[model samples]
Target: MYKDFGPTKAVTDMTLELKRGVVTGLVGENGSGKSTISSMISGVYPPTKGTMTYKGQPYSPKSVLDARKQGIQYLTQEQGTIDGMTVAENMFLGEEESLGKKGIVNIKKINARSAEILKENGLENVIPTKMVDDYSFEERKMIETARALSHQPEILIIDETTTALSQKGRDRIYEIIAEQKAKGTAVLIISHDLDEVKHLCDEVVVMRDGIYINTLTGGDIEPHNIRQNMIGREIDGSYYRADYECSYDEEVVLEVRNLSVSGIFEDISFELHKGEILGIGGLSECGMHELLKTVYGALKPSSGSVILKKNGVQLKNTTVSVKNKIAYIPKDRDKESLFQATSIKDNIVTAALDKLKKGFIITPSSERKMADKEAANIEVKMRDIEQQVRDLSGGNKQKVVIAKWMANDSRLFIMDCPTRGIDVGVKEKIYKLMNRLKNEGIAILMVSEEMMELIGMADRIITMKDGKLSKEFERSAGLTESTIISAIV
Candidate 1:
């Protein structure tokens, strides 16, 4: 199939087939057209050229509902559940007639059904009657998975959905996929994590520059081989930091003293030093995410202070933090970090507006120069800076977020899952960038669910359990996932 957005060719002459009872994996670099192909197959977008055949018949869907009616369901990488709607409502949205008689909908019947689905999918704690907006990103993702599975789809497309999920949620998804495979359902999973693709997929297809690459099966489904085929090059084995020592300056940059956020976290005290990479790891509900946001001044603490040691100013809001040259890369890039409808240039230059302005007036050329320089510096794949950020892939959207902060020349970066949903190549770039930032004496407080990332990149690792610091490990060859997992679990 061929898909084009204006002059940009998202998917070019992509020919593919899914086999029943077989799990297919799609691996590609950012903007390499993995999601686009999945979207077309699920009827989210129409193909410009080429055609698809399903069950020995021509299949062309006009809309997502049309595709779902034909036993095809998709769960997108982005937030798929609607806010202000109950979990049950969101699950049975398009098919409410099944849960009602005549023209009236039976809310209780749907809620009970939704509850059963949630329990079966290992999300029994989620209240089906509660609004989806009240749940965390990870919970909402599992809820979306439940909704997709409720239909018993013949073809299921999981478009990078696991990137937002915690390990428990991911394991639940794996269980569901295994069950689906046993039922002879064809499953297509798109992921940047090569190991996940290797573990879950029976056959892996590679795509590059919107064109179809070779497909690997059996023993060929290795990380290095998949990485090379996706990026068209051989990446070094050492994709993370090489050092085994925890070294940083004696000067402290930010200090959190007795930080308490109501019931979220309490007595969270830590000192971030210059040139240090302080990594925080924990379960999705352990409150580390809220702690990072509180320190960044995005969340109001019940009692305690986050002070910038440079000037001894108490951090109270996002404006104050940004003005103090502190950057934040949130995990929920779409809703929390990016202005979806804005141009890439606008998004990048928004952070550097203070520097782009001369006195009180800012020129268009100055904005353009700053945006262009930072976007190119981060190597954001786009037709031009004028393109909307929502048009870019998940990894590219992350690049735009990093580029925006880079333009501001931030002194300290509070990154939450900085490499989440990004490809290995961009992850390598970010790891290298973090190293460079640390070498230049910039402090980094990174919160990641990926223990390997913390072990591989951090100078010091802190694990959180039940809203409290459980363990702190200094960087050494002895640091491993077992040590960290012991603290978290």
Candidate 2:
């Protein structure tokens, strides 16, 4: 398949085959055309050249609905559910004709049917009559999956869906994929997570710069080999921090005491030491993300307090958090971090507005200089600081986000899934940057889903389960994935 966006070739002459009863993993860096290929196959976009054959016949779909009618469904990376609509409404969005007569919809019957489907798929608590917006992110993901499975698709394209899911949700998806394989349904999974791809896929196809590089099967489908093929180079063994000793100061920089967010998280108390990389690991819905917000004072906790002591002053709210030089790197960088339509200069200078002011007015020259310095510090690859961040690749955009904090010279950092969709090469740079910040006595509270990352980077790891701290592991050579998984599950 070939696809081009004006002068740029998004995908080039990529020939591939998905065998029946097999799960083919697509591994690549962001902007490498993995999602593009999956989107093309699911009829989200039309290929500029090349043809696709299904069941030994020419297959060309005009739209997503057209593809779904032919037993092909795609679960996109972003949230697929409509906000105002009910679960039943979102489930049968395009295929509403089956539940309606002469344009008159049968809401009660359709909802009943939807409820049944939800119950069967282990989503009993999700009411079909309730609006999708009322549900959690993980719940909405399950709804999208249920909708896809409703089509009884012969070919399923799951694009980076597991990243947003908790352990229970991911296990459900695995079960669905296993069942689909048993039914001889072909599955194509696009993921940055090599461990997930290795565990679920029968074969792995590596892509780079919109071109197919290599394919691995059986014994060749290992994490190191897949990483090498995807990036076209061998990564160093010490990609993460090599030292196991705790390098943090004994003095507490930030303290959370008996913090409770109603039903989300209860009595969550922890102390972050100066220069510490305090890692928070949990399932997606374990309230870790919410805890980050609460600590930042974005979400008001029902009880207890978040106290950030910096420069002998205490931070009590969002305003205080900002004034005290605390920075936040949210999980959704596109929505929370970068201004998509704005220039890279604007993004970098956003957090450092006070520093950019010349007398009474904020000078353009000051902004440019600050942006340039921080961008250079983080090694952000862009044409110029004037370039719109939306035009940059995922890694570059992320660098721009981090550059803002660097410009602010933040003392405390709260990062949630900082390297979620980032490629291995960029991940290494971010890891190095985090270590550098720790050495500079900047306390960091990192909330992440990747187990290996926590083990490799953290001075102390705290595992949350059912809105509570389940286990805590100090940095040591004896830390293992199995030990962490036991606490998580």
lDDT of 1: 0.92
Report residue 468 deviation for candidate 1 (angstroms): 1.1
Worst 10-residue stretch by lDDT in candidate 1? Answer: 164-173
Candidate 2: clashing pairs of residues: none
**Tens digits of per-residue lDDT for model 2, 99-214:** 88998888887998898888888889988889898987778988999888876789999988877777788888889999999999999998878888889999999999889999
Model 2 C-alpha RMSD to native: 2.8
Write down the TM-score for model 1. 0.96
Give per-residue CA lDDT, model 1, range 1-489, as digits (tens).
899999999999788889999999998998999999998899988899998998999999999889998999898888999998999999998888888999799988999999999898778899999999999888888888888887789999988888888888788888888999999999999998788999999999999989999999999999999999998988877789998999999999999999999989889999999999999999988999999999999999999999999899999999999999999999999999999999999999898788887799999998889899999999999989999999999889999999999999999999999999889888999999999999999999999999999999999999999999998999999888988999999
Q: Each model's TM-score, in the order given? A: 0.96, 0.90
Candidate 2: stretches off by over 4 Å: 283-285, 311-314, 338-349, 359-397, 485-489
lDDT of each: 0.92, 0.87
